[model samples]
Target: MTKQYSLKHIRNFSIIAHIDHGKSTIADRLLELTKTVAERDMQEQLLDDMDLERERGITIKAHPVTMAYEAKDGQTYQINFIDTPGHVDFSYEVSRSLSACEGALLVVDAAQGVQAQTLANVHLAIDRDLEIVPVLNKIDLPAADPESVRQQIEEVVGIDASGAIACSAKTGVGIADILERIVTNMPPPKEPEDDLLRALIFDSHYDNYQGVMVYVRVMSGEVRKGSLIKMMATNKNYEVQEVGIFTPSEKPTDSLKPGEVGYLIANIKNTQDIKIGDTVTSQKNPAPLPLPGFKHISPVVFAGIYPVDSSDFEALRDALAKLQLNDSALHIEQESSMALGFGYRCGFLGLLHLEIVFERLQREFDLDIISTAPSVVYKCLINDGQVVDIDSPAHYPDPSTIESIEEPWVVCHVMIPSEFLGTIMNLCMDKRGSLEKTDTLSMDRLLLTYKLPLNEIITDFNDKLKSMTRGYGSFDYEFDNYRESDIIKLEIKVNDEPVDAFSCLVHRSKAEAKGRSICAKLKEVIPRQLFKIPIQAAIGGKIIGRETINALSKNVTAKCYGGDISRKRKLWEKQKKGKKRMKEIGKVSIPQNAFMEVLKTD
Candidate 1:
């Protein structure tokens, strides 16, 4: 029989660190050390279940698993480990995971030392007042220096690392010491008052066979199968069909009490009914107040996602619906474009989130997609004194509307080696980033703070920073505020008609260069027709840049037998007339790949 432990013996914690800092590997080691999974069935990155996540070597989602560990003090304890994604795109998910836990394992690489994301996650954990256990990973590597990293963590992260655990998840060294620290150092879940049931839903997903599966950290209640549960945020009730805990896989349990982490299935057909950070309680005896931090999340980045083949529109919609069941960060709305036809404009937290959603659609749903250039929400003040929020170029009003445009700005924190300071500063200035301050951590490392336009960093900022620094730089940012900027609506005209889908908002200084680049790329991608097709980038009625696709010459007299010289004229006139007719009626079909090329700025 499975050992049942009281709330005081249960320790709920999450693993947080920088990207590629061995969070998943450490979680895998914990699973093995506790014998949660048989050694014969163990695999690398065992907690990263998604193929995309494994292939990319990043944890894209947060996963929770339960393990029974015997402490050094000889008490059998139940430990719930919530593995969170380290990317800034999924930081909201990480916040939810941290809110559900009482402690966190702060993993840092022995060689790489502290990174940007490490500090970001550390601030989040500290905000939640969670007990932090510092761990230095990858001690088996030749460049590993645990003592130096411990000092860095203490000085930079402002955490006491004297008792930090050093371990190599790859070689299974010091695994037992880490487990013993978890058992003895990390505090257990705090006891709740004797009140009605209330469980916090940190994560949820739609299961095809079982309906809505909600992952809950029971706070003050016990729930079981057939219990009538209500979501406080939505105020909707459902009969609990099943309840279980993840032993890597869902295992049914009789009931989940306080301090336990598990999944509960409620017969919910609509995925919109359950949201992350919601409070689940008993209908018969509800709590007086709902749990804190239950609020709707809003998306910052927006893009239009269209199926390459218009016939797959419904298929794409269905796929998005299913994906949204698990990722509530994605927001979608129905939209149409004259050039791209029908599609949904989707919003995300960041560029990484957008890329992951696109990959999932292609890989999991077998859908070929064309995504437009990502945009940030812009606040426009119109002549009528009404403020309009615009996320797509299709919705941009005419310039004659006499309005000012405001774009979102972010406070970016970049940590890099001090040697590349000049190069990074120059690059940031080119992107319109204004330096606010700089902090010197040591002789070799520095942290740069800048206020940058959100539009500047959405595309290839991170990639370029890595390229310039030789992959030693890391960054994190948060939305600061919207500021007024001199911006204009840039449009691409094919022949004489403007393509709505290719329109975008650009700053006054970059309007000419951006337009020239787009026109040049369009010239290369758009195929030459019978008549010369001119591609022009225009701001209002003035053309700023232009390119032309030369017409393919035809041998009009190749098939003619000699008669009078007038016969040649007649044939030439006929050919010219035909060409004119074709030019008038012929429409250029922009291939899906061509649209994708136009969106690739870097």
Candidate 2:
């Protein structure tokens, strides 16, 4: 059994940084230095347990582990740290992890220095009142300039980096100093146990053999096996079957005490029965109120997910239920499409978040699925002062509501080389974005702030920015507010029949061009039928763009070679009547591939 460390000797912290900033590498070195895992079991990115994370070279979830490190004072201390994702989409994961800690190690790349996401994460830490320790990583690279980066962090991030540790996480240089600083400079959890039980649920996952396992940090209580617990927000009670801490792997423990981060298992058959950010308390001696500062993060982007095969719908729903247990930000509801049949309309934080969930549904659940074009939540104000928020095009309210529609907007921060400033600004302007502020961080680097409609950024804007700046640009965004905009639904019609799956919301200024582009794409993919198929893009009752697929024909007059011209005319009339009748009642057979054609549209 592992020895138990007192609350005063335990330090809980998290590692936060920008994408590709060596955050995971620093985590690897820390695991090695603390001997958390045996030498034979130690590997690169040990905490990244998912195969997708290894393949993408990114951290998707926040991983927590307990490490026992003997300090120079000849005493062993329990260091509980969470390795968080650096991507902008997973900022919610970082925030939830930070709430369980008293401090965070703010790692900035020595070469790339501070980027957009670095500042965003630092603000999250500051909001939680966490002590931020600046650690300059990747100093072994040839372009490394630790001194300049320290100054950059101070000037740009406005953090005191005078005591920043300059280390190469790749070469294990100065790693020992980092650990020492964490133990000395960072403070331990100060929440005292007053015979009241309150454990904050940080994260969770589903297990088939056991049940729903919840990841939590004890703030001021102790929970052990056989302890009856109650979720304050949910008011659900369960008998604790087990309580343990993750030593890189689950290690069964006698009990979880205050200031320790651990997991608990009970009779939670359904993932929805437990709520994240809920306070867990002793059922017999429950707390009077839940913990403060629990904010429910809402999804900004919405899309429809349908199984490729109709039979896997139930499996898809079950897979999403399990995923929801792990991810609280993902919202799903039952929805159906005229072209795609039954599916789920899921809301995600961003495009990347939508994509990651889509990928996981396929990989983890072993299910084949297709998702529709993503849309942003639009608030519709009725003429009578009633408000309705719509995410799917099918759910859009009647246009004659006699009021304005409001679209969600975001404040986007972009950090890039000064040479690419003009191109970036022009690109943003093309996407209906307005420049708010431009600050020059250094002679080469510039930071530009832009306010843009959330719908504009959901497309290929990130790809365009990377291509234009040659991958040197860093981007981050936060929700601002809803503003009134002239937004309309762009519906696609095949043979005068509206395909609900192909419908989406578009801005008035770009509706005609967008409608034209989608019609052109559909014309290229949809197979030609015996009758003429007129593909049209429309807004309400007006058609904006059209494409025609000519009917395939075999000349009926060809069989009357050298016959009378009257007979040939008679045969042509018959063929024309048949074609007209076919066009009147023919059903447009839209294949599954036709549904994806709109999804891939730029």
Task: Give the winner by lDDT.
Answer: 1
Q: Per-residue lDDT tens digits of candidate 1, residues 377-434? A: 9999999999999887777887889579999999999999999999999989999999
Worst 10 residues of 2 by lDDT: 269-278
lDDT of 2 by residue, 1-602 (tens): 66888887999999888877888888889889998888999888888888988888778877789989999988899999877777777676677788989999998889898899888989999999999999999888999888888989889888899999999988999899998998999998886848688899877777888888998999887999999999887789999999999888888899999999999999898777666677899999988888776666788899899999999999999999889877767899999888898999999988888988999999889999999888999999988998988898887888897399999999999999999988999999989999999988888999999999999999888999999999999899988899999999998898888988888889999999999998998998888899899999999999989999888998887678795799988988999999999888888788888777778886
Q: After superposing candidate 1 on the true structure, give the runs of residues whose Cα lies further than 4 Å from its correct spot.
A: 553-586
The TM-score values for the models, in the order shown, are 0.93, 0.94
What does the lDDT come to for candidate 2? 0.88
The residue pairs that clash in candidate 2, if any, are: none
Give candidate 2 misplaced runs (Cα > 4 Å).
191-193, 555-574
